[model samples]
Target: MSRALGIYIHVPFCKQKCVYCDFYSLPRREDQMDAYAAALRSQLFETDFSGCEADTVYFGGGTPSYLGPRRLAALLEAVFAACPIAPGAEITLEANPDSAGDPDALSALRRAGFNRVSLGMQSADDGELKSIGRVHTMAQVRSAVEAARKAGFDNLSLDLIYGLPGQDLPRWRKNLSA
Candidate 1:
Protein backbone atom coordinates (compact mmCIF):
# COMPACT_ATOMS: atom_id res chain seq x y z
CA MET A 1 0.00 0.00 0.00
CA SER A 2 1.19 3.47 -0.77
CA ARG A 3 1.65 5.91 2.02
CA ALA A 4 -0.56 8.98 2.10
CA LEU A 5 0.03 12.41 3.54
CA GLY A 6 -1.61 13.28 6.86
CA ILE A 7 -2.61 16.73 8.00
CA TYR A 8 -2.49 17.63 11.67
CA ILE A 9 -4.16 20.63 13.30
CA HIS A 10 -3.14 21.64 16.78
CA VAL A 11 -5.67 22.93 19.27
CA PRO A 12 -3.66 24.32 22.12
CA PHE A 13 -6.25 24.52 24.83
CA CYS A 14 -7.28 22.26 27.66
CA LYS A 15 -9.48 22.39 30.72
CA GLN A 16 -6.46 21.52 32.78
CA LYS A 17 -3.01 20.35 31.81
CA CYS A 18 -1.98 16.93 33.05
CA VAL A 19 1.20 16.90 35.07
CA TYR A 20 2.84 14.33 32.83
CA CYS A 21 1.91 16.23 29.70
CA ASP A 22 4.25 18.82 28.32
CA PHE A 23 2.27 19.68 25.21
CA TYR A 24 1.46 23.16 24.05
CA SER A 25 -1.78 24.01 25.77
CA LEU A 26 -3.27 26.48 28.16
CA PRO A 27 -6.49 26.65 30.14
CA ARG A 28 -9.51 27.71 28.11
CA ARG A 29 -9.57 31.43 27.48
CA GLU A 30 -12.86 32.52 25.99
CA ASP A 31 -11.51 35.70 24.47
CA GLN A 32 -8.57 34.00 22.80
CA MET A 33 -10.54 31.19 21.20
CA ASP A 34 -11.89 33.26 18.32
CA ALA A 35 -8.55 34.82 17.58
CA TYR A 36 -6.88 31.44 17.67
CA ALA A 37 -9.44 30.03 15.26
CA ALA A 38 -8.95 32.94 12.90
CA ALA A 39 -5.20 32.54 13.05
CA LEU A 40 -5.53 28.85 12.30
CA ARG A 41 -7.78 29.62 9.33
CA SER A 42 -5.31 32.10 7.95
CA GLN A 43 -2.46 29.66 8.37
CA LEU A 44 -4.39 26.91 6.62
CA PHE A 45 -5.33 29.19 3.74
CA GLU A 46 -1.84 30.47 3.23
CA THR A 47 -0.25 27.03 3.26
CA ASP A 48 0.14 24.88 0.16
CA PHE A 49 -0.91 21.27 -0.07
CA SER A 50 0.49 20.81 -3.54
CA GLY A 51 1.40 17.32 -4.75
CA CYS A 52 -0.40 15.68 -1.88
CA GLU A 53 -3.84 14.39 -1.14
CA ALA A 54 -4.38 14.09 2.55
CA ASP A 55 -5.70 10.68 3.49
CA THR A 56 -5.94 11.59 7.14
CA VAL A 57 -6.63 14.77 9.05
CA TYR A 58 -5.90 14.66 12.77
CA PHE A 59 -6.72 17.35 15.30
CA GLY A 60 -4.27 16.76 18.14
CA GLY A 61 -2.76 18.76 20.89
CA GLY A 62 -3.53 19.77 24.40
CA THR A 63 -7.11 19.10 23.53
CA PRO A 64 -8.72 19.57 20.12
CA SER A 65 -12.19 18.83 21.47
CA TYR A 66 -11.90 21.74 23.89
CA LEU A 67 -12.58 24.13 20.97
CA GLY A 68 -16.22 22.94 20.96
CA PRO A 69 -18.19 21.86 17.90
CA ARG A 70 -18.76 25.18 16.10
CA ARG A 71 -15.12 26.15 16.10
CA LEU A 72 -14.08 22.62 15.23
CA ALA A 73 -16.44 22.69 12.27
CA ALA A 74 -14.99 25.97 11.07
CA LEU A 75 -11.50 24.59 11.35
CA LEU A 76 -12.49 21.47 9.41
CA GLU A 77 -14.04 23.62 6.73
CA ALA A 78 -10.84 25.61 6.40
CA VAL A 79 -8.83 22.39 6.14
CA PHE A 80 -11.16 21.01 3.47
CA ALA A 81 -10.80 24.26 1.53
CA ALA A 82 -7.02 23.99 1.67
CA CYS A 83 -6.74 20.52 0.11
CA PRO A 84 -8.63 17.59 -1.25
CA ILE A 85 -9.27 15.19 1.62
CA ALA A 86 -9.70 11.69 0.32
CA PRO A 87 -13.13 10.17 0.55
CA GLY A 88 -13.52 8.28 3.83
CA ALA A 89 -10.36 9.94 5.04
CA GLU A 90 -9.78 9.15 8.68
CA ILE A 91 -10.34 12.34 10.60
CA THR A 92 -9.54 11.99 14.27
CA LEU A 93 -9.84 14.43 17.15
CA GLU A 94 -8.05 14.09 20.44
CA ALA A 95 -10.18 14.91 23.46
CA ASN A 96 -9.86 14.67 27.18
CA PRO A 97 -12.65 13.01 29.09
CA ASP A 98 -12.71 15.80 31.67
CA SER A 99 -13.36 18.28 28.88
CA ALA A 100 -16.19 16.51 27.07
CA GLY A 101 -19.10 18.30 28.61
CA ASP A 102 -22.33 17.55 26.77
CA PRO A 103 -23.55 14.87 24.37
CA ASP A 104 -24.76 17.58 22.03
CA ALA A 105 -21.19 18.71 21.56
CA LEU A 106 -20.21 15.27 20.32
CA SER A 107 -23.19 15.18 18.00
CA ALA A 108 -22.27 18.52 16.60
CA LEU A 109 -18.74 17.32 16.03
CA ARG A 110 -20.08 14.34 14.11
CA ARG A 111 -22.13 16.69 11.98
CA ALA A 112 -18.92 18.64 11.38
CA GLY A 113 -17.48 15.58 9.55
CA PHE A 114 -15.35 13.95 12.19
CA ASN A 115 -15.81 10.18 11.96
CA ARG A 116 -13.31 9.22 14.62
CA VAL A 117 -13.09 10.43 18.19
CA SER A 118 -10.14 9.59 20.39
CA LEU A 119 -10.61 10.27 24.05
CA GLY A 120 -7.76 10.63 26.48
CA MET A 121 -9.09 8.38 29.15
CA GLN A 122 -5.57 7.81 30.43
CA SER A 123 -6.77 5.33 33.03
CA ALA A 124 -9.97 3.65 34.04
CA ASP A 125 -9.04 3.94 37.72
CA ASP A 126 -9.94 7.14 39.54
CA GLY A 127 -6.83 7.07 41.65
CA GLU A 128 -4.61 6.76 38.61
CA LEU A 129 -6.40 9.60 36.89
CA LYS A 130 -5.96 11.80 39.94
CA SER A 131 -2.34 10.78 40.39
CA ILE A 132 -1.66 11.87 36.85
CA GLY A 133 -3.32 15.23 37.42
CA ARG A 134 -6.11 14.40 35.02
CA VAL A 135 -9.25 16.23 35.99
CA HIS A 136 -11.56 13.40 34.99
CA THR A 137 -12.81 10.55 37.11
CA MET A 138 -13.48 7.01 35.95
CA ALA A 139 -17.16 7.81 35.85
CA GLN A 140 -16.48 10.77 33.61
CA VAL A 141 -14.55 8.59 31.20
CA ARG A 142 -17.45 6.16 30.98
CA SER A 143 -19.85 9.02 30.46
CA ALA A 144 -17.69 10.47 27.73
CA VAL A 145 -17.49 7.14 25.94
CA GLU A 146 -21.23 6.69 26.17
CA ALA A 147 -21.75 10.20 24.87
CA ALA A 148 -19.45 9.60 21.93
CA ARG A 149 -21.21 6.37 21.09
CA LYS A 150 -24.57 8.04 21.34
CA ALA A 151 -23.37 10.74 18.96
CA GLY A 152 -22.97 8.04 16.28
CA PHE A 153 -19.24 7.70 16.56
CA ASP A 154 -18.28 4.03 16.32
CA ASN A 155 -14.67 4.52 15.52
CA LEU A 156 -13.72 5.63 18.96
CA SER A 157 -10.36 5.09 20.61
CA LEU A 158 -9.20 5.66 24.16
CA ASP A 159 -5.70 6.47 25.29
CA LEU A 160 -4.14 4.70 28.27
CA ILE A 161 -0.80 5.11 29.93
CA TYR A 162 1.02 2.43 31.87
CA GLY A 163 4.21 2.31 34.00
CA LEU A 164 3.14 5.28 36.02
CA PRO A 165 4.84 5.94 39.32
CA GLY A 166 3.87 3.19 41.81
CA GLN A 167 1.94 1.36 39.09
CA ASP A 168 2.34 -2.39 38.76
CA LEU A 169 1.44 -5.06 36.25
CA PRO A 170 -1.65 -6.03 38.22
CA ARG A 171 -2.87 -2.47 38.25
CA TRP A 172 -2.17 -2.16 34.55
CA ARG A 173 -4.07 -5.35 33.85
CA LYS A 174 -6.97 -4.18 35.96
CA ASN A 175 -7.01 -0.86 34.17
CA LEU A 176 -6.88 -2.56 30.83
CA SER A 177 -9.74 -4.83 31.79
CA ALA A 178 -11.86 -1.94 32.89
Candidate 2:
Protein backbone atom coordinates (compact mmCIF):
# COMPACT_ATOMS: atom_id res chain seq x y z
CA MET A 1 0.00 0.00 0.00
CA SER A 2 1.16 3.51 -0.74
CA ARG A 3 2.01 5.72 2.22
CA ALA A 4 0.18 8.94 2.90
CA LEU A 5 2.06 12.24 2.62
CA GLY A 6 1.65 15.85 3.55
CA ILE A 7 2.33 18.35 0.75
CA TYR A 8 3.33 21.89 1.56
CA ILE A 9 3.28 24.58 -1.10
CA HIS A 10 5.09 27.78 -0.22
CA VAL A 11 4.07 31.18 -1.55
CA PRO A 12 6.85 33.64 -0.75
CA PHE A 13 4.93 36.82 -1.41
CA CYS A 14 3.55 39.28 1.09
CA LYS A 15 1.86 42.64 1.07
CA GLN A 16 4.47 43.85 3.56
CA LYS A 17 6.99 42.32 5.89
CA CYS A 18 6.49 42.20 9.60
CA VAL A 19 9.06 43.95 11.77
CA TYR A 20 10.10 40.73 13.50
CA CYS A 21 9.82 38.37 10.55
CA ASP A 22 12.99 36.63 9.41
CA PHE A 23 11.49 34.49 6.70
CA TYR A 24 12.53 34.86 3.07
CA SER A 25 9.60 36.79 1.62
CA LEU A 26 9.19 39.46 -1.00
CA PRO A 27 6.96 42.44 -0.48
CA ARG A 28 4.42 43.70 -3.08
CA ARG A 29 5.84 41.69 -5.96
CA GLU A 30 2.58 40.79 -7.67
CA ASP A 31 4.17 40.69 -11.11
CA GLN A 32 6.18 37.59 -10.21
CA MET A 33 3.14 35.64 -9.04
CA ASP A 34 2.21 34.14 -12.38
CA ALA A 35 5.75 32.97 -13.08
CA TYR A 36 6.07 31.61 -9.60
CA ALA A 37 2.82 29.73 -9.89
CA ALA A 38 3.88 28.23 -13.21
CA ALA A 39 7.24 27.19 -11.79
CA LEU A 40 5.54 25.60 -8.80
CA ARG A 41 3.19 23.66 -11.06
CA SER A 42 6.10 22.48 -13.18
CA GLN A 43 7.93 21.33 -10.11
CA LEU A 44 4.91 19.40 -8.94
CA PHE A 45 4.62 17.61 -12.27
CA GLU A 46 8.35 16.88 -12.41
CA THR A 47 8.52 15.40 -8.94
CA ASP A 48 8.10 11.64 -8.57
CA PHE A 49 5.54 10.49 -6.05
CA SER A 50 4.24 7.39 -7.74
CA GLY A 51 3.57 5.39 -4.58
CA CYS A 52 2.28 7.99 -2.23
CA GLU A 53 -1.05 9.71 -1.70
CA ALA A 54 -1.24 13.22 -0.40
CA ASP A 55 -3.35 13.42 2.75
CA THR A 56 -2.74 17.06 3.43
CA VAL A 57 -2.00 19.96 1.11
CA TYR A 58 -0.96 23.08 2.98
CA PHE A 59 -0.32 26.41 1.25
CA GLY A 60 1.92 28.38 3.58
CA GLY A 61 4.31 31.27 3.32
CA GLY A 62 4.47 35.03 3.10
CA THR A 63 0.72 34.60 3.15
CA PRO A 64 -0.91 32.14 0.81
CA SER A 65 -3.92 34.38 0.68
CA TYR A 66 -1.81 37.08 -0.90
CA LEU A 67 -1.68 34.95 -4.05
CA GLY A 68 -5.35 35.72 -4.60
CA PRO A 69 -8.15 33.19 -5.09
CA ARG A 70 -7.72 32.63 -8.82
CA ARG A 71 -4.02 31.88 -8.57
CA LEU A 72 -4.54 29.69 -5.55
CA ALA A 73 -7.26 27.81 -7.35
CA ALA A 74 -4.98 27.30 -10.32
CA LEU A 75 -2.23 26.00 -8.08
CA LEU A 76 -4.64 23.68 -6.36
CA GLU A 77 -5.86 22.43 -9.70
CA ALA A 78 -2.29 21.67 -10.62
CA VAL A 79 -1.82 19.83 -7.36
CA PHE A 80 -4.81 17.65 -8.06
CA ALA A 81 -3.69 16.94 -11.60
CA ALA A 82 -0.14 16.07 -10.53
CA CYS A 83 -0.67 13.96 -7.45
CA PRO A 84 -2.81 11.19 -6.15
CA ILE A 85 -4.65 12.74 -3.20
CA ALA A 86 -6.39 10.71 -0.54
CA PRO A 87 -10.11 11.05 0.07
CA GLY A 88 -11.09 13.70 2.59
CA ALA A 89 -7.68 15.26 2.36
CA GLU A 90 -7.08 18.36 4.43
CA ILE A 91 -6.40 21.30 2.14
CA THR A 92 -5.33 24.29 4.19
CA LEU A 93 -4.33 27.83 3.28
CA GLU A 94 -2.44 30.21 5.54
CA ALA A 95 -3.87 33.68 5.30
CA ASN A 96 -3.64 37.11 6.82
CA PRO A 97 -6.87 38.75 7.86
CA ASP A 98 -6.42 41.73 5.58
CA SER A 99 -6.21 39.59 2.48
CA ALA A 100 -8.48 36.70 3.38
CA GLY A 101 -11.43 38.59 4.80
CA ASP A 102 -13.29 38.85 1.53
CA PRO A 103 -16.41 36.70 1.52
CA ASP A 104 -16.40 36.23 -2.25
CA ALA A 105 -12.76 35.22 -2.31
CA LEU A 106 -13.25 32.84 0.58
CA SER A 107 -16.19 31.27 -1.17
CA ALA A 108 -14.19 30.86 -4.34
CA LEU A 109 -11.36 29.23 -2.40
CA ARG A 110 -13.78 26.89 -0.68
CA ARG A 111 -15.18 25.90 -4.04
CA ALA A 112 -11.65 25.28 -5.21
CA GLY A 113 -11.29 22.44 -2.69
CA PHE A 114 -9.76 24.21 0.27
CA ASN A 115 -11.41 22.80 3.35
CA ARG A 116 -9.28 24.41 6.04
CA VAL A 117 -8.06 27.93 6.70
CA SER A 118 -5.41 29.15 9.12
CA LEU A 119 -5.55 32.85 9.80
CA GLY A 120 -2.80 35.06 11.21
CA MET A 121 -4.27 36.79 14.21
CA GLN A 122 -1.12 38.23 15.72
CA SER A 123 -2.91 40.18 18.40
CA ALA A 124 -6.31 41.54 19.28
CA ASP A 125 -4.87 44.92 20.24
CA ASP A 126 -4.50 47.37 17.37
CA GLY A 127 -1.37 48.81 18.96
CA GLU A 128 0.27 45.44 19.26
CA LEU A 129 -0.63 44.55 15.69
CA LYS A 130 0.84 47.80 14.52
CA SER A 131 3.94 47.31 16.60
CA ILE A 132 4.49 43.97 14.91
CA GLY A 133 4.02 45.58 11.49
CA ARG A 134 0.95 43.53 10.75
CA VAL A 135 -1.21 45.05 8.06
CA HIS A 136 -4.41 43.66 9.49
CA THR A 137 -6.47 44.91 12.37
CA MET A 138 -8.30 42.90 15.05
CA ALA A 139 -11.62 43.76 13.43
CA GLN A 140 -10.38 42.28 10.19
CA VAL A 141 -9.54 39.08 12.00
CA ARG A 142 -13.07 38.83 13.32
CA SER A 143 -14.49 39.56 9.90
CA ALA A 144 -12.22 37.00 8.27
CA VAL A 145 -13.31 34.32 10.70
CA GLU A 146 -16.92 35.10 10.06
CA ALA A 147 -16.36 35.11 6.33
CA ALA A 148 -14.48 31.82 6.44
CA ARG A 149 -17.31 30.17 8.33
CA LYS A 150 -19.83 31.58 5.97
CA ALA A 151 -17.81 30.29 3.04
CA GLY A 152 -18.26 26.71 4.30
CA PHE A 153 -14.97 26.25 6.10
CA ASP A 154 -15.60 24.19 9.18
CA ASN A 155 -11.95 23.66 10.00
CA LEU A 156 -10.52 27.03 10.95
CA SER A 157 -7.45 27.85 13.01
CA LEU A 158 -5.72 31.02 14.15
CA ASP A 159 -2.10 31.99 14.71
CA LEU A 160 -1.25 34.15 17.70
CA ILE A 161 1.89 35.78 19.01
CA TYR A 162 2.71 35.88 22.69
CA GLY A 163 5.36 37.88 24.53
CA LEU A 164 5.15 40.67 22.03
CA PRO A 165 6.42 44.09 22.92
CA GLY A 166 4.19 45.64 25.59
CA GLN A 167 2.22 42.41 25.85
CA ASP A 168 1.26 41.53 29.40
CA LEU A 169 -0.72 38.76 31.04
CA PRO A 170 -3.90 40.76 30.84
CA ARG A 171 -3.28 41.52 27.19
CA TRP A 172 -2.49 37.91 26.42
CA ARG A 173 -5.68 36.86 28.19
CA LYS A 174 -7.61 39.41 26.19
CA ASN A 175 -6.13 38.11 22.96
CA LEU A 176 -7.02 34.57 23.92
CA SER A 177 -10.56 35.57 24.65
CA ALA A 178 -10.75 37.71 21.56
Error of 1 at 169 (Å): 1.0
List ranges where model 2 is wrong by over 4 Å: none
lDDT tens string, model 1, 63-141?
Answer: 8888888999999999999988888999998988866757899998888889999989888888888898988898988
Q: Number of the top candidate by lDDT? A: 2
TM-score for all models, in order of appearance: 0.94, 0.98
How many pairs of residues in model 1 come into backbone collision? 0
Instruction: Give the Å error, residue 175, model 1.
Output: 0.9
lDDT tens digits, residue span 1-178, model 2: 9899999999999999999888789899999999999999999999998999999999999998999999999999999999999999999999999998888999999999999999999899999999989999999999999999999999999999999987899999999999
Pick by TM-score: which candidate is best? 2
Candidate 2 RMSD to the correct structure: 0.8
